[model samples]
Target: MTDKIYNVLFLCTGNSARSIIAEALLNRAGKGRFRAYSAGSQPKGEVHPYTLDLLRSLNYDISDARSKSWVEFSADGAPQMDFVFTVCDSAAAESCPIWPGHPITAHWGVPDPAAAEGSESEKRLAFADAHRMLGNRVNAFVSLPLASLDRLTTEGRVREIGRSLSEAG
Candidate 1:
């Protein structure tokens, strides 16, 4: 296998919750095999508090997490992404900037936990649920035989991972 480390970007409307969670999960899960980044079309300008808490509770390092714009990754000198995923419905439906490398893109839409109503406990549960869903998808993705698969097959498998949750129920 080639010692190529893949770069993955997770996109969402706000970059505060879902995408942030995905980034953390993939980075840790992929180990040194992938570098994960998260950004938004319209960044909230800060990481969501509950997101930080969720990640911290799970023992993920939150030091590098921040809400950033997709424009940052599109610029020259930014790491070229091998894969790009949209984790929110709004971001998936919007027009995205043309990525330099033409990375394989997929939609892994999950409900906005930050949009969850009710008490703090309920909102926290929403974040946890989002975390769980994203975790399942990311786990499936990392389990793929990436090095052995052709580009077309790899793309299909990644997209399939996003669909597994809905298809499961």
Candidate 2:
């Protein structure tokens, strides 16, 4: 296996829940092989409480999980991403910055847990569900034979993963 580490960025409108969840999931699940980061088109300036709670309960480090703009990734000297996935419908629909390396992009849109209306328990459940969906997608991503597949094949596979799993809910 090649020693190259893939860099991934997850995008969302808020960067509070779904995108943060995906970042944490991939960083943990795809450790050594992949590094994950998250950003928003319109940042909320802080991660959602439910998102922090869910990730903390799962033992993920939340020290660096602040909500920030995608512009940060597009700026000079920023890490070049190999993949970018939009985890919310709004973010997917909006115009995004031209990434430095022209990363393979896909929409893995999921319901916004922050927008979940109900009791506290119900809100928490929404975050948990987002985590579960993102976890499955990230796992499938890390399992891909990236070094063997051509760019076209890899892009198609990534798109398929988003379509199949994001549509699950």
Candidate 3:
């Protein structure tokens, strides 16, 4: 792979939470390393309000955030993804789109923040945790020598990276 910035897609069932966090983190983390996008296997039709709040609190420019379908990326003219990660446990287990460019796929499931119970603070905590965990993983991923890793090495590394992202932070 050349040193050009690679496109990454993070998917979930809703596209309203985890996948959105992952996308925002990667995109804000740098300018020309990894271009991130997100979608849902079954979109919830709107980006979650809490998701927007968390990003804004961190000063992330999320004015453009919205829930979208993974099918867009499946199109021939869409940005060719170098990596496609399903950020929801449900989406990770469900069927995925047959991608163009054969992007390296991984699963980095984070428990749904919207599913968090209790008070508002507790729900915020869940979002914060997911945001941090995904942020850490995306940070580490972009730091990897993706352009240098060989084919077999990259495939194995993608899984390793996913585990590291899911378990860390």
**What is the lDDT of every predicted structure here?**
0.94, 0.92, 0.86
Query: Model 1, clash count?
Result: 0
Off by over 4 Å in 3: 1-3
RMSD, every candidate, angstroms: 1.1, 1.0, 1.4
- lDDT per residue for candidate 1 within 1-169, as digits (tens), equals 7688999999999999999999999999998898999999999999999999999999998999999999999999999999999999999999999998899999999999999999999999999999999999988888888899999999898888888774451
Q: Arrange candidates, best lDDT first.
A: 1, 2, 3
Residue 139 error for model 3, in Å?
1.2
Candidate 2 segments exceeding 4 Å error: none
Candidate 2 residue 93 Cα shift, in angstroms, is 0.8
Q: What does the lDDT read for residue 25 in candidate 3?
A: 95
Clashes of each: 0, 0, 0
Superposed model 1: Cα runs more than 4 Å off: 167-169
- The sequence of per-residue lDDT tens digits that candidate 2 reaches over residues 1-169 is 4788999999999898999999999999987799999999999999999999999999999999899999999998999999999998889999999898789998888888899999999989999988988888888889999999999999999999999986674
- C-alpha TM-scores of all predictions: 0.97, 0.97, 0.94
Give the alpha carbon lDDT tens digit for every residue of 1-169 in model 3: 4658889999999999999999999998856777899999989989999999999999998987999999988887899888899887889888787888788888877889989999999999999999988887887777778777887887787778778656556
The TM-score-based order of candidates, best leading, equals 2, 1, 3
> Which 10 consecutive positions of candidate 1 have the poorest summed lDDT?
160-169
